[model samples]
Target: MTVALMWEARAVAGRGEELLAWARDQGLSVRPLRRETFRAPGDRVLVITWWDAAYDAELPELPEPEGELVTRPVHRWRFESVEQGA
Candidate 1:
């Protein structure tokens, strides 16, 4: 099965660039099949990683950034791929 993990965070005021850089620099011990990072107008950064594993399987995920760098705690979610319609 294919699983996708989502990590999202909002940086402190005016520090969006730093936050974006920090997210891009993070590394996972077990590399994902694919990874992508995104940013939004609210200084929010989102990272999605695809993995080949069971839905309930243990997997590595991005850690929280330093408290000083963000306005609030990070949010994360996991989802398993479903069959595509023909």
Candidate 2:
């Protein structure tokens, strides 16, 4: 099965660039099949990582950034791929 992990965070004030950079620099203990980073108008950064594992399997995820860098705690979610319609 394919699992995708999502990590999202909102940076403080005008530190979006710094937050994006920080997120991009983060490394996982075990590399995923694919990883991507995104940013939005609200200084929000989102990272998605795809892995080859079971839905309930233990997996590595991005850690929280320093308190001062963000306005609130990060949000995360996990989803397993479903069959595509033909």
Candidate 3:
């Protein structure tokens, strides 16, 4: 069964595009909910991404990202056993 993993990235700076692209290239199909800019004293932006099992991989030790990430938000939830197609 496929599952959906939802990530919430708040106040992210730099490397957003890179991460998104990398995940896709690795076979994770993501549906971006929103990438908005705001001014609230610190939390400036929010990025929500939904990814599923198509991107599954064997966990491995990897090096640091080619670019640095200023801020990051943790993934919030995992909805399991998702059904695909009609």
**Candidate models: Cα lDDT each:** 0.95, 0.96, 0.38
Q: RMSD for each model, in Å, please?
A: 1.5, 1.5, 8.0
**Quick one: ranking by lDDT, best first?**
2, 1, 3
lDDT digits (tens) for residues 1-86 of candidate 2: 99999999999989999999999999999999999999999899999999999999999999999769999999999999997576
Candidate 1 yields a Cα-based lDDT of 0.95
- Top lDDT hit: 2
* Of candidates 3 and 1, the better by TM-score: 1
Task: Candidate 3: give the clashing pairs.
Answer: none
How good is model 1 by TM-score? 0.94
List clashing residue pairs in candidate 1: none
- Tens digit per residue, CA lDDT, model 3, 1-86: 34444444333455556454443343223333322222333433222333334446322211223444426434344455546577
What are the TM-scores, per candidate, against the unseen true structure?
A: 0.94, 0.94, 0.31
* 10 residues in a row with least lDDT, candidate 1: 77-86
Residues 19-82 of candidate 1 have per-residue lDDT tens digits of 9999999999999999999999989999999999999999999999976999999999999999
Q: Is candidate 2 or candidate 3 better by TM-score?
A: 2
Q: Where in model 3 is the C-alpha error above 4 Å? A: 10-12, 28-67, 80-86
For residue 19, model 1's alpha carbon misses the true position, in angstroms, by 0.7
